[model samples]
Target chain A: MIQRSQLDLRKFVAPEFICGHGALQLAGRYARNFGMRHVLLVTDPGVRAAGWTDAVGESLTEAGISFTIFDAISVNPRSRQVMSGTEVYRAEECNGIVAVGGGSPMDCAKGIGIASSNMRDILAFEGVDRVPVPAPPLICIPTTAGSSADVSQFAIITDDVRKRKIAIISKTLVPDISLLDPEPLTTMSPELTVDTGMDALSHAIEAYVSNASSPMTDVHALEAIRLISSALPAAVREPHNLDLRFSTLLGSLHAGLAFSNASLGAVHAMAHSLGAACDLAHGRCNAMLLEHVIAANYEAAPDRYDQVGAILGAAEGGRGTPAENVAAFRRSLGVTETLAAVGVREDAIRTLARQAYADPCMVTNPRRLTCEDLERIYAYAL
Target chain B: MHMHSDPPDDRDALREKIIGLGETSLHKSYYPELQSRLAELERFRALLDQTHDAIFLIRADTGRLADVNASAVTYLGLSKEELLAMPFASLIAPHQKAAFLETVRKSNEVPSGSRRTCTAYLVSREGREIPMEITVRSVIFGDEQYIVAIARDITDRILTEEELKIKESALESSTNGILIADLTGAIMYANPGFASIFGYEQDGVFMGKNLEAFFATPSVGEEITGHLLDNHTIVKETIGLRSDGSSFHIQVSGSVVQNDAGEPLCIMLIVMDITERILTDQMKRKTYEQLGKNIEQFAIIGDHIRNPLQVIVGYVEMIDDPLAEKILEQSCRINEFVTQLDRGWVESANVRQFLRKHGDGGEPPLQTFIHIGATKEEDP
Candidate 1:
């Protein structure tokens, strides 16, 4: 029983974004509008191989702009790679950034922009609003439909030293523009498509029940939930369908707008810890831990969780509970990996629990979770 | 001004920021950086204006003024709008717009950071022209190319150079040997006269040689340097050693040149060759000695003549004949002549004393040569 009144103060921020088939091609035009002279094109090997990097490069070249391609990125962007990309940005005298990949490259591009503008190491900006100076112009062209890092004001970089992911949270991390083109989403493999689709579903669920959720965020969150629950299964079945891909892209964008404003809960906090500890995929970690976190946190915000359950429950022909419906949805999308199946051992749960307990994303959890409670949650996922 | 908060307080602040409530929390607007960058540019502009050199930013494509500094206004005696409206080349000497266009083209042909310098006269608003050394460099900011012209007034430098040339001519053609040496007695400069006197070419190895090498006694040069260091000036006659190992008299007058702080910088010595004067002095001394001996001989000869005359008078008294009387008279005459010879000797000795007192190097007395007034003994 959460009640909202018009008197309560709230704020919403979304980047200037364009959505359609040719949205990614308009990156160069938007970059020029932002006064970008030379740009650093950030992407991964997969995205570059899929021809997104070349297409964007052609667009920039046609617009009479210069760019340097830095494709040294992984599924989980490392602080080392972020700093390396920053080195390229400075060495080439690039004045702007264009990220053409999934969340890893986009998040890494955000990290690079922050580091280059602040003239410091990326790890120094680990806390919230720590960046006193904003990064240069950033344009994101997300290939996969997850992470929503293109629209979200969050950049997660793995600190290779501590073997964990550090979050740099600032409104400044929001990109200047997001080119939401679903054509690039057709090139994702079935597993990547499933994993990324699950990531979008987790974002909507966590944001809808978050303590920081507002009327504005709730509208985007519930709609995101309804869209993802209905489209994610069919999106995995027909990975090449533009309509299915566009639905997922639109759903991720809506969820990004929701969570970017409302923030996340124990699921993201625990997921960041698990992803960093196991060296696993971020989407997979979220997909594995999403149901477990929902079960543990169901008692804190029952009414909000009930609304979320109704959308997912309707998809499952009215299921048992919100947590059960989420599990069934993840399974239907063919994401059925347990924590141990992904190489997460039982002994590492306490350290993972302690780290998640301290994550900034944990601050918005509906229920305050202790280290012991998080350890039990990790155990349940295992 | 900045106090560190407690850890819990830090966490609280971070949470507030995570919820977008911190003082610095905002979306990526770039307003602050824009404000800071604009302020920095203003500071840089102020710095440019503070300099005495006139700075100009010209659009490379149009050869037109894009910007100008404060000094440019003061130099051209024109308002900012007036300067900006005119073609940049119109401000140059003779208003050669085509020439400046070519210069800009040449400057742009080189690499971005390289520059080229040329001398030009800047025609002012009052029609007065100022000589300037203009260094032009091509610069780029974003999409537009600009030419940065930094003009420095060279009037003072030109005048200084002309004055230096005149002084150098004087040193080159001087008749007196002028030598400049460091405090350590090493020769730094020697004028043409100095090189000629020392039997060395103007570009010879004598340069960088110690001043002691030119002194007959090396220690004489050292002593003079020490004296000049302590006393600041010295004028003494010393022996000089020529290249052929010959020594001659040299009159050297020297002084230490100091900077505005009154600290000694170098030694300047003016030397004159006095060997002929010394030789002439020795000859005059020898002649005076010989003249003194001749006068003494005259007195001795007078004594011998008188003695002989007296003996002849005695012989005449003994003879008692008329021949004897004649002989005695003749002897008396002779004795009187000897007395006159003695008087001549005394006069000659007085003349020698007078010559020693007033003669110029064995010449007769100045009054005797002029014959302005005869001496008391010589007057009739």
Candidate 2:
């Protein structure tokens, strides 16, 4: 109880509309609610394979909401793709965008909105709260159970020119509605399920302990952690399990809300670097790097780690210190020893570490790590 | 005659003195019993004044402190005079002052023996604070309804209590899913994180929605839960399902939460969602399998090319290293066989792009998701 009386400000901003389980069935109605005469459906091929594209198209057609499909987006959305999407938006005279996939298509849609309404280059809005105008009323229907991009105000686009991933975090980028239909998520391949599920876990953990965390964020973050931790593995092993898939979807949504406000830490920082340099799966890279970053963060606040350990039920009163807790945590996650096993080479460690240090996510890390320390972490990871 | 007159007067005076002496003797006989009774009263008074705990004598007229013992001054940090002048309500913490005053008002109706006590913080002379356990009673002292309060310092004890509370809160708000359950999988305690994981409110008042609700595959859950029960410890990466029908894959490490009796009151489960690592592991396994199949297919292709090439090499070796003059005479035929075989092998083997890509400077094209039939058909 300090006399200074630090007032804690709390905020919760979710998508205005959340139709969780069978939400996609009402896609047209929701799209119409946005008052768009013509809707542009932006998605990737994998989503098309899952047959969600046709369902969305049919729903819109049945409801008499006019729509055009743009399915050129890939796993990592590119500036060229956004430009092309913008062209499609203009040619079709599509008044709104319904991004119906994981993060990439939605991110591209946001980029398209930026390019169409305001700017020539997508990279110009490549940081926090940079985009000035609200994106064209976008409704996000996530076909995957990961990447809370639908509700998040952030968009990540790849810059082929620089061979780097650019993040556009603008409050105006938030979607008008997020429809998480478990039907589409059940089609996720086991690998996709695992990768995306890990991404959600990373989001939850990072937000739960972020420097900018508030009690409100902490509540959501902790809930996300609990639900994701309990449900992700099951979802991965049995994608068709409606119960598990639904829980994960809800959990991921909460996690997205949390991290959007609280932000993330070094795991994301390092993962972004890996995504840029190696083009590895973001979730896989995060999982690979999570423990090492946890170990590094251990020294910053051992007491917090102990509390976290106790909360995880990994530590008892008579148990060992924070080091033991961290080790136990990694072991529990079933994470392996090094980045070497993940095809990352020793020679690339220095470059990756330097890039990781430059990542925006590193700003809120509890520990102020030096370039040398990050390099050592990369070496240890290897 | 004169001796008789003096003796009579002396006799009369001696009788009056003797009567007074008898009266004094009777008073002296009862003195020891009175002395013993006075000694007992003084001893009781000393015991009350010298006690370690605070003793308060309250006035019925004003409900204020009439007198406080030496210990009261030390415990409450108030001088005897100040304590005697101040109302009991003044000693209470600001937040609790009204509550204490209300309780005192209610105690007025209650009988003296039925007077109650509670834990409270008392203010001191130096403005320092100390928590105390105080007992008050209604007593008749000199025809007034006076209250006696006995209080003791509990500062250290209160600090310990505060520490425990902080620890409990920390555990409750932890980010990790923590569950302390019995061997029967009946949950004894769950942190807010744990409750949220299974899609239950941290303070949800619902029963029958325990650890069983989280297991996506009930059979696996039962197996692991049973294992933890029997073994007192189990740690594994497994899957859980939430109430909303979504699943989570987690790594669970559990240990026995035991009671003082040494019997397991509960098992604490520390669950981590390793869905990311598991997915990567699955990917690695799939890739390894794919790599194996590719390698084996390449081996068959290798043998087909190597067999004829090896025969041609055998023939060439005979021409290059002939054993004798007779063997050397066969060199021309060997030369013809080698040249024909080399030409046939080279001509028949097509330059497969898969092999060429690996052998040439170009790297293998990375696997990416591409939509089939997505490209528009261009007219010639």
Candidate 3:
């Protein structure tokens, strides 16, 4: 929707990625290309329990890549976990890393690689371009349908003491290869499937309306919206349908590509603060706040939102506002929840608003937001 | 009431359905995986404790001391348990605590993995202030954010640096011109004295210039280079050319600077302008030569006058007349005067002395008879 003359200079970056029913099988081959004799395998206990970690590990063993499993990572991966993983990597003499799980494991793996190579505390690499060197050879096999950390130049780690999530953005954070296998989605619960599907939807919308969005990113962003809107419901209803799961996985991958290049808007900014403070699921927070952020930014990027509405099957030739269309879509997925229901309190709105306004994602938000505006949004969501 | 009655009978069936969904969502057992990772976590703690620099882990939000390593306990002069129980500010010097806190705040505000350095002082248990260069970075461990500060004591380094600065200042302000040139004769450094000697007001004007350019001729440059190449210190008088194309005599003492391995690194040339000293030496030589010639000439003149006067004295003494005695006395007096001049005693007034000795009067009229141009007669 942005005119050619109005387009600014931009750059795009993404990891080499493969997506299919069994793309997880390629993790070993990619690790071998990096000449990894021994690798540190990063995953959360949840992913390990789901048996995806074993599948990836078996492939590594088949390829003769010996590995040490580091399954201490948690949701919203902590810096301590990253440091602990780095210790394991150094102790085991791992030359490479293979992350198996969702965004949390991938991000934790990136943190481990950075810490191992730089030999510094993981907290030192928090902002854009803060990483001075590339992480060790990393291959990500994402089991979740959302949180495209495998291909993104971003690693969101929770600062437990500060009760916040720190965004570490650098090109070095992007994995060497992202092997996304949709087959893993069949094991996810219906709640997780719905949550991640909405997360993918929010990524597409936010990327499309972001101030940094370019023509290259817009194509992927709009296509992601169409794919997610058409496939998320079916995938949620029938988790074992490989075709529906693969469609959602591809949609999430495209959305990741879009946002990784164009960045995201206030939806991510607010969700990061809310999720960090309240310890909620990242995807659910994004889903709950997407419509409100779109409503606030609709006037600033109306045409961009109109296209998003059209992709989501809004009536009246997509002439209706993006907020209404997104809200309707979210309701269709049975995700009607207020901020209060998600553990956000009226008293904590001020702190959450201040932190959200300070998030790095706020730089790419379509509309300028202040702490007051964010507080009002939080209040409205509640 | 009628609508609710229809659904009441299916409560038991609904519970079973809910239980089945819960069973399906439950994840597999993770206890075995958690047990193995706990050992790795212990290894991580040991690794942190072994670092040489005193390391402190403080909570990013509260500035509480979460952990301290063995080195920190030794450096702070406190036990590990005591150090861990204290606040982060307790280790910082009172005046530096504010700056330390501010640096911690900035480290927290920045993204994880970004490091900031601050030079601050820490208070040891003995109440001594130890200067430390601390590097602070935010790290998340477990579920909490912490600032990992690595502090290194820099007291010795600071003292060494201060001493080096003083020595450097002395060399820069030396009076004798100094130049350091590479093996190929390209000048690398020229102190102020070296610049001023070459009529350059700025020292930088001499940098990167060939040292041979400052010599009066190529041959002089070659002679100095040969001596340096032989690893010998050579001190010689030579001519040096200034920037204005004028040459002056200079005394140069040069030696080759070598590394610990005895390989030549550079040539150091110490030069002093000795033109004035050379001119003074030349003048002294000319004056001495001229004085020697004048003494020789005076001897010849004395021989010629004294020989004739001696003959006159001998002839006048043999004739016993009063006038003959007068002539002998005057001749003897002239001979004495010639003797004085031959002895280089021209400052003595021998004519006045002779007149005063022989004249029959209280005060002889020596002024009336001894008249010379610009020479006033002395009082007798």
Candidate 4:
């Protein structure tokens, strides 16, 4: 939290959300109240196979709302996929959107909403606060405990031609309602659970040390770090434990409230660049790059980083610098690979660093990093 | 932690929104939007009510009136509540109600945008059936199917058509040869009277023929048309040629038919067969000439007898006998009779002039309405 003497100005925005068991069943009633008669149900093939899509569909049917399924989405959603989903949204004459899945489908749902309402290409909105018109009513039923896309005002879509991801940030991108039920998270594989939990931990740590951190954001960020570090390992060991899953879900929601307001740092910026260049999983990319970026930025805001480190528990009696402890925590979760092991070449570090330097998230980073500095960090992680 | 925070700088709208200070940074509440939508719907409803055509919305499944515009109330003379209570099919004419319902059922099965149009009479509150041209289409709103119908009144159009039919019958039944021709003297229409007088069958075969075909001299048709164009009317007795190439005297009275703007549209000619009148006039002329010659001879003979008798009386008077006195008396009597004969001849000339001036008091001379064209009457 900011000192009283240094406190200047800040704001926090959070969407209306409910987290509990059976929370996903309320989507139909909320959609009906929002006057959504016809809905475009956005999901991924994996979530559809997991039966979350069927469960949501049944709810919508019970409320007498007609919906069409749109599951043509990949892990990292492309602009073309968003455009195709928009076409389905229009062809079915849908009035609203209901996303049931992880971050990919939720972010794709946001792109589809704004693209359809504004009648423009999805990439036209690349930077912060570029959306001039609010999207149609979006009700998000999150099937994963991480990504935090359900509560955050951010939509990340990949530009196929450029081979880079663009972030569309606007307060209007926040969903009207989010149903955070832990039952859907049980279907996630152990690897997916660890990768997503590490992502939440990165989010909390980055938001806590960001230059834009305020008293309001610090409270949520530190609590998120504490909850994720304790609950993630047990949730992976017992995938059916509702209590562990709910703790991780709450942690992710709190981290979303923190980073969405305080913005992110070099970790997210570098992860976005690496994911775009290599077509790797977003959570794994963030998990691998988190400790390296913290080591680079620790000197700029050591006291804030120290608070995050103290609350963020380490694995196997880990002790050392805050960066070493975070690395040990990730390795304990079985993400024990360097950048080269994950297919990142040494010659591409310069280009990836340059791309990360241009990311909008760098504006709120605690340390102003140069392209060479980012390249050095990438080499050290490898 | 909030301690040791960096100072904010270079503020912009994007940065403001990132920190949630932008003007539109708020949660997604739909109350204001819903109110705006309802207001727009009210405006549209008002626009529909202002139209002259009666509009109705009927439930496709139940056939009941779901909604109605203000004009529907005015046209049907029923209260809004009463209209909403009844089925849409009951509002149509009794004979067409069954067929209308069938069409509505078919409309529900077709594509939503396609429309079916039919003519029917709308029964009003006073039991008066008014003719209407109705257009109906099926539409889906929410989960319900509805049929939207618009009805336009066609009472004035029907009355106008009936009036035109009566005028057409009058023209067909006229007795005079009423032939309406174009400006170029081409026959546009020749009624039955014209066909019969021209010795042709009334099958309208002569329709495209020129008016010059009926005149004994083709130039006469042109001259009559020119007169009508310049003076607007023509009345004259001219020789007519029939389909069999027979010539007869006929009187043609024609005028130019002008539009409201006074531009000549066509020429209408009323023709009369005056061949019998012409033949009678010719016989009358010959009889009058013969009678004048006989009167001249009779007067001459009377003068011849008077002169001889007077000469004989003068010779008898010189001898101074009784017979001389008697002969003078006889000359005086003969002179009186000769004077009477001269007076009778003068009266006979006056009678001939009177008969020539006036025709027999029947079938008065036909004159074109404008009466501007006239020509000399001849024997043949």
TM-score winner between 2 and 4, please give it: 4
Worst 10 residues of 2 chain B by lDDT: B368-377
Superposition error at B185 for model 3 (Å): 54
Pick the DockQ winner: 4
lDDT of 2 by residue, A300-320 (tens): 755545555554443223355
Computed on alpha carbons, the lDDT of every model, listed in order, comes to 0.86, 0.72, 0.83, 0.86
Clashes of 3: 18
lDDT per residue (tens digit) for residues B4-119 in model 3 = 54666768766744553221222232322443475588788788778778899898777778888888888889987787777888789999899988998898899999999999
Worst window of 10 by summed lDDT in candidate 1 chain A: A1-10
The best candidate by TM-score is: 4
Docking class of 3: incorrect
Please state the error at residue A83 of candidate 3 in Å.
1.2
Cα error of candidate 1 at position B274, Å = 23
The better-scoring model by lDDT among 2 and 4 is: 4
* Residue B341 Cα positional deviation in candidate 2, in Å, after optimal superposition: 99
lDDT of 4 by residue, B1-380 (tens): 56536555655766956754334544457744874697699899899989989999999888899999999999999988999999989999999988888888888889998999888999999999999989999999999999999999989878998998897788778776889999999988988988888898873987788888999999999999999999999999999998899999999999999999999999999998999998987776666556556655675586577678778877887897867777778877887776666556556545655665674533312232112111111101
Better of 2 and 3 by lDDT: 3
Per-residue alpha-carbon lDDT of model 2 for B141-183, expressed as tens digits?
6668887778877778888989999989888778778777666
Worst 10 residues of 2 chain A by lDDT: A1-10
Candidate 1: lDDT of B307? 71
Question: What's candidate 1's DockQ score?
Answer: 0.03
lDDT by residue (A1-382, candidate 1, tens digit) is: 3455646788899997878888888877777666678899999999999999999999998878999999999878999999999999999988889999999999999999999999999999997999988998889999988899999999999999999999889999999889899999999998998888788888888888877889898899988888888888888889889999999999999999999988998999999999998888888899999889888988898888878888899987866788888888888778888999988889999999999998999998888888899999999999
The lDDT, on a scale of 0 to 1, for candidate 4 is 0.86
